[model samples]
Target chain A: MSSTTQIPFVDYLILDDPPYLQAQECKSCGARYFDRRNACANCFANNFQPVAVQSEGVVTSFSIIQMGPNPYVSAIVDCGGTNVKCTIMKVEPTPDHVTLGMRVKLMTYSMGEDNEGTEAVAFGFEPI
Target chain B: MGTDAIWIIGSNMTKFGKHPDKDVVDLAAEASRDALQDADISLSEVGVLGVGNLMNASAGIGQQLQKQIGQTGIPVFNVSNACATGATALRVAIMAVKAGETDVGMAVGVEKLAGAGLLGQRGPKPEAETWQPNGRFGALSSTEGRIGTSIMPGVFAQVGMEYGHKYGGASFELFAKISEKNHAHSTLNPLAAYQKRFTLEEIMNDVMIAYPNTRPMCSGNCDGAAAMIVVSDEKMKSMPSEVQSRAVKVSASVLTSDPYEDGCQILPDVNTLTKNAASQAYEQAGVGPEDLDLVELHDCFATAELVHYDNLMLCEEGGAVDFFQSGAPWRDGTKPVNVSGGLQSKGHPIAATGIANIHEIVMHLRGEAGDRQIEGARVGLAHVIGLGSACGIHILEKVA
Candidate 1:
């Protein structure tokens, strides 16, 4: 029931230079959807174009995780399109201070470093 | 309206978790036989069969169980509802007797986690490639960032952190205390997963799983089964006095599903469902929480039990820590809880947890809960909550 905005493949690749966050958008309903799909999640409109969105939103809800496979800041972001919930990277002092409606900007980082030291970059949010 | 009253005649359960020698069918049949033998009844006397199994992993559980139990003609219905499968089955059996559908019905909840081995034993998986904005696939699976982790501990840890932040204190001490208490109680329960006692300091300093949550605070995965037999008063009258003496009446059995609201915490939803269920149960049993002698709540994590205290109205919100510190909810407490160690110590085999809770309450009411029995328990309550926020609450009273 909530609206979502998608980040186009071209925009994501140009921004962080990765294909993981590529998304598609519908011009009719203005709903953005993540993951590569030919059809839009809303309005079922096939008419769409590539666009770069500022990877920033406010933290709506967050949890200070303790016992997980890999500890990270998990939260929901109201990115003016669809309030997306995503894990943030390189944030410190726990997710408690990342209060509701607090500004957060996305960053490219890896959860854990690889052997080659050229970390696998993924999209994460941080306090603005 | 039914003329006869439904009474629980007997209950039995096997130790939970990873028994290679026993498969799911074996566990169900074994527990069924044990329950029947405990009641001194034969398989032919079972007019109907109800089975609760969440994940039997490609095995045709219902058909297989009927074959294993040697019950050929009677109706055997298989029920599944994430973690509340066992409780759901029990409800069906109770209703059948209450509605005059059958004179005798058996409810059995079984799981064979051991057969799955390690890789197959992982927690619930994601639906597909649809990635959630939270970097996770769905509600069940972990984020791509964190694989091989469980959602139970992770979700509860989030609750713990929120509670800590709002209350201006850390939850480590409370979590440790809860673990310590359940562990102490488990020492007296022979069937519990972990019988070793743990100190608060030990629980606090143990290996961390998520923040503020230690390994001991989380429940371990295991395999096992539990079963109970219910019969109408007319059928029960023909049984031996010893069997009749153990009869426990079903006061209430209620189930509820998830609410439509998003961002709603899991524990609060459980509280709402519990209150609704308990109110109905108390009215039917002619008693209230104040009159309860003992209870067995779903304690998959230490924090879960603590949250239950407030949710079950044992204490006020933010009052569980104080109530727990006062040594209440213990075997000697006014209203003892988790005397069988709960899921924290007893092991969580998903579907089996509900019937398992009922099994403990029946034992307590029968004055057969060796060592951990609440002295002269007249009324007891059991609450089992599952994934997707499904919950079942059963209230039992000893038949005079």
Candidate 2:
């Protein structure tokens, strides 16, 4: 395993001065995605350009999953460009606590540490 | 879609739910055997066998299941499209018969959803990834995937919430009502997993799974198998009068994939896919939703059933609540959605679900739905959705 203490969980995630998410934009259309696609879902474009997306967005939808490997607040956050599925880091998974149309920003933190103490980091959005 | 007569001569299904005594192969072979028996045909008569399955953790299931019934070297094709696997398999069978590729074909679907085994595994090797959000869709190395712990339930609960957000007066109560009705509908289905009814209060009070979704509101993870025998119309003419009178026509079988676009939305996401498939199916059948007498839709969640009400054109936009309250989706309701208790009550065995939906409709088309039977039901539609994703819509009409 790499000994990097600050590792972005997914390849598209870039840990910069102020962390942000990167997505692939279809050359044929303005549509963007978190990962590389062989072909665009829109216009069937094969060429794409990587662009930085502001983690800041509004919650379009949310669901509190109670039965799973972990019980958490799952939200579909629309960042003006695309929708991302992730958990709300700082909120409970309840309708009363998490409201629709709430503003949120992308946040990243160490998820867990390995035996070597190297931390595995993850990204999520939190209510602004 | 062809002039050639294709009819559903046989249908068979195992009582859905957790089956401790049955393995995946056992379930497949048993259902296939019963289907062949029901059709009054020998295994040698079936030229091709199409199998639908989701997880292949227990690899080579098609061949493995064939071994249980003594494989005769007839080719077995396996199609996996998450939950739509079964429907896709049946579609392939229908297409083959329509093309005269085979006079008789067998379509079978089987799955072991929960228990000591993982979703697809037949052993006790705790494959915890099955319980993870997005299954294989989520990138484990991605920070986005790690934070998204909510999978299907959370995704659908958002659908319910979004429907309420868009159309006032829709909430958990409406979702629970759908669940309550399906559970009640299951009470009349002998093959339904949960053949019992729950009140709205009881449904709402059930264990909270996703915020708006409870255990009862969501489909149960269980093991089961279902099968259908699709025969060419030419072959149909040779069958006995009794069998000929019970034939059901396959008017349309349409399937589609997700059309991803900018501004990705959730509750609205499925509606787009469903609408496309439903329209294509209606066109292929040369009929509109207005002609549909009963529907066996993918009720993977309560919201799906509710949202699909509008998507399939069963009701006007934001008209689900009023349409539902008017008894449109009840057992005796004009629409009669999920007369087999739907996946919410029948237990979703992934691949088996589509075939199960087909079995339910065939029963209704043949006037054999018994207690849940709709008088003079003629046209019916069966639907299934898989998350990678694929949507399948098939229209079945009774033919004498």
The top-ranked prediction according to DockQ is 2
Name the lDDT value of residue B24 in candidate 2.
89
- Candidate 1 similarity to native, TM-score: 0.78
Give the clashing pairs for model 2: A9-B141, A9-B142, A10-B141, A10-B142, A10-B143, A87-B147, B5-B233
Q: Residue B353, candidate 2: how far off, in angstroms?
A: 1.2
Interface RMSD after interface superposition, model 1 = 8.5
The lDDT values for all models are: 0.70, 0.80
Regions more than 4 Å wrong, model 2: A1-5, A68-70, A112-121, B114-145, B263-268
Off by over 4 Å in 1: A1-70, A75-85, A93-123, B1-4, B115-143, B146-150, B165-170, B265-269
Candidate 1, residues A30-125: lDDT per residue as tens digits? 555543446653456777755555567765435545544556655655565544546665566353554555788766543333233322234566
Candidate 2 residue lDDT tens string, B1-400: 3777578888999989978988889999889999888887788888788898876734778789878896888777888888899998888888787877789999999998864222321223333322222322344342223555336776667776666666756677888999999999999888888887899999999888777888898898888999989898888888888778887888888888877645442333777788899989898888888888899989888977888888788999888888898998997787889988999888898899999898888888888889888878899999888876789998999978
What is the lDDT for B342 in model 2? 93
Q: Is the docking of candidate 1 incorrect, acceptable, medium or high quality?
A: incorrect
Lowest lDDT 10-residue stretch of candidate 2 chain A: A112-121
